[model samples]
Target: MTPSLTEDGTLPAPAGNVIVVEESDMVDLFGVWDLVMVVSGVAWHLFTVVIFGWIVLRRHHFPPFRTRNLRLLGFMLACGILFWVCQVLTSLTTGRPNLPRAVCVLISPWLAYGLGLDLYMTILAYRLYLLYWLLVLRYPLRQSRRFYLFPILLGVPTALVLVSATASPRLVSTTHYPNPGNCVYSLMYSALCVVDVMIHIIVLLCLNYLCRHIEATYNDYRETTFGSIAFILLTIVAVNVFIWIGIGPPLYGYLFDREEYLAQFCVKLAADGLSCQGCHRRVDGSSSARLSYPPANPLHQHQYQRPTLPPGTGSYGETRPNDDNNSGQEDGRGTPGCSDSRTNGCRGGDDSLVEMAPTSRGITQQPADKNGHIEEWSLAHVAYHDDESNQLADKDYTGTSSAPHPPQHDRVIIE
Candidate 1:
């Protein structure tokens, strides 16, 4: 049976007109501090919900509760709600104090008892996931499946022990007290917090190992994506540390004073929200920048033109023998023939036009050779013999050399 106290130091009339004496020692439940806690708690909870909704909407899946950051965020929101409930209960039980003190005293115990523990657990889960990933990634892709079984075996037992120890009814009552602020104390709760710290340490070490493994595996890719990701993770760790250090102990103090809880929650709401925003930058650059190169510099673009080569060369601009009539037989030793009709020195029209063939602006891809080898030959290698006089004069001498000059006397031919 619950005790209903009347301020007059006697039980109120059970059936007659009873004056329910309001104790001056007891404060009203609604006041400035409670108003702040309600506002801040409501705002943060909504912010978390909005972010979570965005994630789910973007991914079109159940919100990723398993991810480390997201999971921590969820836990924080949950803790906030739990703290709110505790404040409400305290208000109800302690003859309804003014808002701030009422809220603080009620929510303090839950915050002290479980909030940090929850965050610590979240970090541990994430770190363990990272460790598993590293172990899997360390081996060949085919053998990674062999490494996955260990997490389930280890994780289940650890979780079971933590949950069973904390959730016991006897343990729940020990951490709380009845003098306006109730707290339950049990080895389970204490052990849980200790485990949280230890696990967080382990996870932090695992994160270091995971990052080292990533650096080792992808030495080149580490500079760009890895740095960004590392910054985000480090930021998360920093924020976690701030909260662990900043909000943690104060929460215990607030368990005895509702006003303090509201104040702390309000301050935390601002600081942590700002920290989250700073930490959550998109990893990839903007979509437009990712898909396209930056605009070309107009001033620099005008400085260069495609170079021309001697006559009778392939599209790659390499000089071929006059007798090398097989225009399509581009082997691996040489570059692929240019397909642009403007550079028709081999079989098409004006050779001069080939030199002036408008270059592909964004990218110039080399065609594959006869053996399917693609060589990106520079534009300077192709020749242009658009002049009629040069064309007619070179047309009569078809021995092998594309140039009108005779073979050097020092050149030796064994064939």
Candidate 2:
């Protein structure tokens, strides 16, 4: 009769497929598939560890890695590296294909709770933060107080998932003692898996919203350096999902298959690199964009207008003059109660006139007012000097006002 295949290759009845075997028999039964599985799993774990280490070291060297989002990124990467290492090592020693079950049993409840689901949730949460900043806040992203929230949100859910996962026995081990550890397939573990899928979907949606927001805010405008980097990041996220969905399930059923696992590992590493690139791209791009424009100079752009009042203070001085009044009141000087003697010199329609004396022996005229002094280099002053010279020449021809008494007055040459 055909024998039942027990967890450790044991049989209930003596049959054609069954053979009396010890631990050595078990090792032989493991075969090529087992060796391949073990090697590939170990390699993948190692690769992840190396990648995570590199990320941490690089972040420390530079400051962008120090951001809250990036910090959470490090945590997630570290968790993934640790998770895979534990799962792969346990499977290799025991010669089993069901690693998730082994992980639930052997690994610390705290790590199992936080490391896996928490990290996965973070990817989505980070995306959501980006979305909220762009859409709701409508504020340009700079280093601000918003980054601190990441660790708290990430930690809470991870702790809960771990607690729930460990609370159920079926999620960790399927069979009782005397049987080789049975790789469990249970509801709690399945829930964790579902969470993974849902979080990914949320991340994708957030990315979509981000793209749309960018389009709306910067429509027809030239794309910034940050824009390009953000696009690359989005591309990487997309690629990550594609690869995980394509390769993840195949490896689950056939963990003993070495070639397939290695392929998955390679894909995962590439995806992680993409994620790092995305983050740095955004950070560097933002910095570059920030430093791109020089501070605006009002002097260079236009003639400097003296600050008369606070910003947005209405132009209170621009109203047209009322002609009915004898005294020019509302020309930013004399009004109802206030008196201004300067208006006497500014007679007739000419607002530019300033009476000055020819300071000489016989010619006795009042000195020019220091308060109404115009700059010698000014265009108005230069024009007035020329016009005054012409007027003096005309007066001489008409025999009206006599020329200055040069003998009596030592003329101070106006240089």
Candidate 3:
């Protein structure tokens, strides 16, 4: 039998193979691939870090930051940074010579746990956006901070990370070539990718459902900022799914690949920046749409007219004369049962015959009967009735005689 390959040794070609590859060729290949991964990973992460930093620093420019959803999104970006750092360190340490084993051990768990947490936070950020949209539409659903924040953002992800760590404490372990280096870690990483794929699918479904609901419910759906953000999120999820499928499998140590990280970084940067922009637009729109009510002015009270009674009706529905009869009555100094002098004004016919004077403060109730006592009515009910009374008092004073109304009489009637 042919000699078996050692654990750390390179594998020989198959018997039928004619080409012979040199050891130098294999070393060069591995070195080139590792360098590519490191460079690409660093560039992608640096770009993402800069974009996220800008968003956070200038969050005030985005009005949605005033809402809780943007705060959750900010937290998610923070988790993404942590995940990227741990993943980059782990990838750098692996398949490299002269690295401290202790450092690898420390980074491995963090990378695993951070991966889980980051995935959870991304889901949470989108979910919060949905909730906020529903709230703005006045949907009757539970949106308390205790309900969404502590339980979903804090409790569930922590539990998942703890359980995953406990179940797979040695998530990454060193291995020799020919046996495939760190095959177990690669498999675990692939599992994470699979989970991410599932999450993206769920998110896609939710976004589609929400978009449809919004389109059906709102007339200005296409013009809304939330609608634009929803579309962006849909695109991001689709891109994420494609990246996961392309690089997630560990068929040949492609798990946690640099290309995959770069794809994710681009998607996140676009989504976050667009979301902030949408929020800023929404704030501007709402402020411009607000309606303001004018304050009440007592001087404008004369513009309001009260309902009028029929021609023959006096104050409080008492039968009275037409204009001709009123002129005859005025010439006789008053009506038959009235004894008041013409200069003294009407009095004592009915205590309810009252008139309102439009004062600087408001309408003031004064008895039409000179000897009648004054009583106040609530301002809330004064508008309709008081305006009518003022009109009637003006007619009585002017129509009572053909002479020009005295200036003192005008002040007393309208003061």
Candidate 4:
């Protein structure tokens, strides 16, 4: 850090690994950089809160991946506030003076620095799970959100909190600085650096995975969204490389603590930003733009756009009420059912139509003008549509079926 203080007749330069100068002198030694870091952390938190609030107020869920999303982000923000509360309480009690080394160590916010950071990582982890499900499962959340995905999302961080609470006292410690009147905590002192690096590495891996998947799946994905994420990913990687600097021991190892905050801010920024990119956001970077989709509409709603007339079967692709050979019948609305066996458009009992799937963040819809019905789609619908729609049994007037029906019969009222 600061140039040798001994040269300026100040307290002799910090000697050895630990501060040899009296603890009281350490306060003035902290200097200005500490204030910059504190301010940066506070500012980022406020900015994230503002963004979170805007999303909540608008009832915008771009990806529509999960319900109560705004509620979930709100709860996370509230949990983060508790840490600031702890810091305030700690400051009020001791005022961070020439307290014994042991006293400050005991009072430094444990949950805030230790478990809290891990909790934030969970947000990034969700993105990873989103991609994994898409690549392998074909349909997101098809395996059972209640028994599997939901529990993992909620329980993993919860489990970490429990373990951290039990183990923190033994694994975490703090260094008190009088000048700034604060206690800087480290998880197990310097050793926690390794743990911190491990966490970031995992985050980096997740980002890398996300980028690769994005390239493969959303090759023509809106460039604005993809570019923003790519910038974030590159920025993080570059910063990490600069800090580590080479294949051996870091040439700039000392700067890690300084750069870590920036790196972390970027990571969380990417996560929060992704929450909005799933829907609405367009190539022009406008959320208010009219909804448009790529050729592969994820919900497979395009098939219902126009009822194609069967070859020489009939006009309007509809079997009249007096068709003597008619096997399929019509509903009161004159909508065709699978009763007509002459045409390939007719269904038997159960045939695949289109299945609604969750998006990355928000829900979208397209209106079938001729069909007089609106079809809903999610942001990540492109990743969802399949040749074989989820087979649904048809037993009632509103019942769904797997029967191969012509575009005319593909229409159904979504309830």
TM-score of each: 0.31, 0.34, 0.34, 0.33
Predictions in order: lDDT: 0.41, 0.40, 0.40, 0.41
For model 1, how big is the CA root-mean-square deviation?
30.7
Counting clashing residue pairs in each candidate, in order, gives: 22, 1, 0, 20
| Tens-digit lDDT track of model 2 for 145-225 | 666565465455455656665666655563332234435547767677567546554554554455454443432113323
Least well predicted 10-residue stretch by lDDT in candidate 2 = 393-402
What number of backbone clashes does candidate 1 have, counting pairs of residues 3 or more apart or in separate chains?
22
Candidate 4 Cα misplacement greater than 4 A, ranges:
1-44, 59-110, 134-136, 139-170, 173-193, 196-200, 203-415
Candidate 1 per-residue C-alpha lDDT over 183-262 given as tens digits, one digit per residue, 9 for 90 to 100: 44467655755665565546545555555544433322234356448868999998798778877777675566544343
- Taking all chains together, the TM-score of candidate 2 against the true structure is 0.34
lDDT score at residue 7, model 2, on the 0-100 scale: 85
Give residue 271's lDDT in candidate 1 (0 to 100): 24
Model 4 lDDT on a 0 to 1 scale: 0.41
Number of clashing residue pairs, candidate 4: 20
Q: Residue 90, candidate 3: how far off, in angstroms? A: 3.5
